[model samples]
Target: MIAERLSLQLPHTKVDPRILSALVCGSALALLALKWTRQRRLQQKLEEARRKREHALMEMRTMSLQFKEQNPSVQLEAILSLPLTELVEKLREGSLSPESVLYTYMGKALEVTHEVNCLTDFLPECVAQLQDLKKQKQRGPLYSVPISIKEHYDYKGHNSSCGLAYFLGTLAQEDSVVVQVLKKQGAIPFVKTNVPQSMFNFDCSNPIFGQTLNPHNHKKTPGGSSGGEGALIGGGGAILGFGSDIAGSIRVPSSFCGICGIKPTEGRLSLCGISSPVYGIKSVHPAIGPMARDVDSLALCMKALLCDHMFHLDPTVPPIPFRDEVYCSTEPLRIGYYDTDGFTLLPPCMKRAVQETKKLLEKAGHTLIPFNPLRMEYVVGELFLKGLFPEGASALLEKFEGDLIDPNLKPQLSVYKLPQLLKRILAFFLRPVVPRIAGELKALCGIGSAKNLWKQHAAAEVYCQEFIAEWKKLRLDVVLCPVMGPAFNLGYLGKLVASGTYTVLYNILNFPAGVVPVTNVTEKDEEELRHYKGHYNDHWDKLIKKAAAGGVGLPVGVQCVALPWQEELCLRFMKEVETLTREKSRSTIGPRIEAL
Candidate 1:
């Protein structure tokens, strides 16, 4: 019976070689032509957008020159030197005209962008907006203050390209809720800054707008997707700007740029009209916040933005206004401090930033308690990496289909784009060699079923509860920790994304977090970094160690975190850190402080 069955097997069918060759060649040629067409189309879109931006900038420059020529008495240097508070005070008192301030910042922005390439579009409509503001009898909180916004915020008549060629010509029909509030508060949205492609990568670069160089060191990234705002603000082009954060988009850039920024609890501020590639990922909700040169500026921005206008425009946001009392309170409270998240070890500069911040806070009479982040490796994998792309990275990968990939986003994208089964097999084999990478690989495979996605979200909630229980057990008012860097080399994050573990923890917990610059990388810090090794003796760790070199004099900052809905308290902590850093800088007691 076996012999009969074997004998019954059909012979394999064969095709003519000539026909097969023709089919293969035809398919290959068609694919090449398709790819070439896409590239050409992308270039056309990119060139058109660049031309529009260039035209806008030229108009702005002409207006700026006319303003300077018209207002011969206006002191551009003095006006630019003023902080947000003083600037607003001058504007309110009629000492500084809105146009003068606007033109001053526009000129400064032009100068800064020449070096850093941080700006996307110069809003010439700001001149018209200034006229509108002049008609208002009463001054608003941010009256006549020029502000730059991250490019993804929807502004009527402008494209929120988000550094992608596909979105280059798609204009917003109306202003974002936040932009509406800014206009209502008398702030001039003079220019929009650049962002990473899809606004996902931490290193700011995209094919259309190019890369934003750090104002401090050209070789280092300014941090993204708020990197343009960071570079602009840090370079003193704009006093206060707005940037959104999911996983350190705001705070990391602020930290790297030696500035201040806050990521309020999700839903605390309106996110309506923000263009997002990950529009509906509820597992890790992105928050909109202010990035400024100082904590006070951030507070002022928050105060102005969290108004009835924002609440009315986006009812999904919590209606609670900014709490002045919480921000101004002088209460001495318990604070938790940690240098390492345990998943990825910080470079010496980052560790020193946290250590020095702890000492300064303790000296200021705030009680400091030691707190260790629990299961951070697990949180990073299951809660963050998995939660972000629960349906799998296919959707995100698709966003980059026809666009040129930023170098910094390519490594992670390559891994995420791998076949699900192949990823799992790779993860299993690398478990012993690079446990963290393996875990991330496994998590990135994603839960293919709805039931599994639900379970994963459930696991995230449980983890947050456990983490909060620990916080409650300690009775901590705030947690002080290192923000991710001393501005790594421009393309560093592409190789080692786990560096984001520091900030992703708070995002997972949905806690309010702020970053305040405390110190500059010291020579001693660089020496210590030479011997640095991460938890794994793997490629990622080696890359991190290599990227941390030559970081001396770069700005370092620490993060201050508070419980959900405690943005006011978080800002208060940031202010305290800023205050202490200033005093310490004056006395030269610790590592060199670089205060904004």
Candidate 2:
């Protein structure tokens, strides 16, 4: 009876199992097709958004050009010349709102970026923050102030490429410590500036973002790795910005662009969450600092950054409070002045700036004493190359593995590919005969290995101590020297990259330094180069020739340095120089303008 029932049911289903299987397969295929169609549509939307964003940027660029053309006077004036401080005060008093200030800066930023490629990421959040501040009535010292950051610093949801294309699309999970501090202080970060690829080269160029040119002269570099910040601030786009310096990264750009930048002592500022190609190696000091048009703005930013809460964000920094007495004092200080580093001499323009600055300081009743750096050639030449690649520069160069390196950096990076064993053997053999040979050996193969790394570190420590001891012996409060030879032409940097010895030496010693403009290039200064005879060193002579030949109308700058954690002193010296220069200019120009 059961078999009969089964047979009847089976026969009724002469709708075959094959037919049922086909129906199931058809359903599965339909679902997959629907999913594929949805995915395609989503991808199309993403592509469309990307295109629209690009189009918007293009439109912004065009508008920037039109705006600049319509308003010519805006290009020559610094952002500090604007009513930013007044606007902030008014915003606090409810007489003005954050939206007005944000709009003004954003428009100005767009205009500046068109003339100079200063921004890497433009901030849309700034507008939103302005609206929020207006609604909440939040009051902070930096409220409604527009700030720009270096690309190396992290900003949540933005790329901290540090000028590498490989890291492009790698969004930061959170803001860097400095960014958080700035945001909490009510400063609106309106843009992220460009940097040298890997933040190594003094000349700012990378495969991802081209090069940042000096606003004073577009053909020449603005200097790097804080070059974009320097260019932006110098162009009057940013009132204040963040910059990091290891080896003249901040100071060089500041000098090249005719602005003020402070390179604080290592660990004085928080470095947490700041990304870079080379991270753990610390033979040379790298610190984050402020770049601005004036020293006071730098002081304002520095005071904001050195608040007690910063120590909580990064335990590595000492809990030293910002000393108001150090910056605000009017007491006379002893300053050391040197026209040359003994290895590479300064050009006539730089030499004249140094001379003029020394005289200005003297007139102000500050003691100016001649100070010769002890063994500056041996120290800077050896330690700079040694500390540059303590763990072997191979890893640093690897970041640019498939990318095109800037022409100016090729000479330096070329040394990274040499065989390690050969370099060691050469160093061992040449140690007795030639001192610089060891540096050359390390440069050729890149210095690595536990023994070599420790040896380099030890040497760096010894040098730092000895340098400080000498400074103590000299009883000096500050040292003034040329930042580099006369401002180099665009492509001429490759020939004189070694001129950085004067600046990089301070980096090795971890001293705080500031660059202040002394004077612009003059015909008299240019003519002095023709009769000059360099130190007779082949490399030095060649560099001098390249610098002097046809580099007539560039700006010249000088550096003021103080001991570790003495950023306040360094800035004080800078302000002194600025004041002296202004006084001299007024005395010189008063009669001419009055006669006109």
Q: Would you list the clashing residue pairs of candidate 1?
A: none
**Residue lDDT tens for model 1, 1-596:** 85456556734545569988998999999999999998898889888888988998898888888888888898889998888999999999998888889988988999999999999998878888889889989889999899999999999999998787767788999999999999999999999998988888888998887889999999998998899999999998999999999999998899889999999999998888999876777678689899888889889888888899888888898889889999999999799989887778878888878888888888999999999999988888888988898866887887787888888788878888889999999999999988988998898988889898888889889988998999999999999998888888878877777889888888888999999988898999888888887777578778888877888888889999999999999999989999999998878844455442
Which candidate comes out best when scored by lDDT? 1
Residue-by-residue lDDT tens digits, candidate 2, 435-543: 3445466554545577877877898888788877878888999999888745466655544545687788888888999898878888887788777766644554665
Q: List the residue pairs that clash in candidate 2.
A: none
CA lDDT of each candidate?
Answer: 0.88, 0.76
lDDT of 2 at 281: 64
Report, for all candidates in order, the number of backbone clashes: 0, 0
Top candidate (TM-score)? 1
Score candidate 1 by TM-score against the native: 0.94
Candidate 1 lDDT (Cα, whole model)? 0.88
